[model samples]
Target: MAKYLDSNKVYRALAFIDPYGMTVNWESIQALKGLGIDFWILVPTGLGVSRLLKNDGNISEAWQRKLEKFLGLDRQYIIDYFYQRRSVSTLFGEETQINKEKDIVTKIGNLYTERLKTVFEYVSESFVMKNSTNSIMYHFMMATNNHSGLKIANDVIKPKYKL
Candidate 1:
């Protein structure tokens, strides 16, 4: 679809609504950036981080394998790299500190922040959408630079609840 859009010169910008932002190819994204194509990514931030951390039934193993196949890296290597990059060591002193052990929210927020930093150059904007209630949705926008693209995304793909 990106190739088609590039060949036909059809799209002005591309918005990727990725659940985890793990499957994305940064090289391809960089190439698209070279072509002057704008991007907005709606990355899952809060609950998704908790889910990944909990990994109750080896579900994360499946995701790990999938990511390994996509990124062509060892699962353990990926885990180590992501953890090292996203570690809140300064905030909590050492890895085994009591404060770090208890504050899952801060840990997850730092993880998401680190992930965002990795792609800071490629994307014009990113958003984190949290489930406000069982039915309602709330969005927190980040890295917002492309005003027009953000406007388009808010208008077209904003979630609707069946209330």
Candidate 2:
């Protein structure tokens, strides 16, 4: 699609990326930078990103690769963003422990939104999606260069509970 879009310079598009897991690479999305496109992406916040973020901050190589690819960020950066290090006094000596931050899903959503802003001029607030257990599972967001499109998307993406 990137190649096709590159060849068709005059084509404007509305692109939606629906990934079941951390399958979408940040580089793929970065290819759409400055294009005449309004993009909507389904970020698997709880199911993918949060699941990869271990409580101890000891992310495995595979998980680190997945996160680095999906987020286009360094593993250390992601770790620092999601976890904090605290010193604990043990019997032997002082030890540092890694603690995962609270409300991580919201932080992940905000991170992805900031990433979108790097490519597009305007980004709409996320439309939060939750599971049957009311756990936040995904965040749907829109990125566009057009301000009018962003305004319309912001209005449309609002969660409707009563209806």
* Alpha carbon deviation, residue 63, candidate 1 (Å): 2.1
> Model 2 lDDT vs. the true structure?
0.91
Best by TM-score: 2
lDDT of 2 by residue, 44-120 (tens): 99999999999989889999999999999998899889999999999999999999999999999999999989999
Residue runs of model 1 more than 4 Å from their true location after superposition: 1-33, 47-50, 55-60, 67-74, 81-126, 133-163
Q: Write the per-residue lDDT of candidate 1 for residues 45-159, one digit (tens) a residue.
A: 3443334543222336776665454344576654553443332466657453111123444444444445444544322222334455642122333332345654664555444
CA error at residue 60 for candidate 2, angstroms:
0.6
Could you tell me every candidate's TM-score relative to the true structure?
0.40, 0.92
Given candidate 2, what's the lDDT at residue 133?
89
Candidate 1 structure, TM-score to reference: 0.40
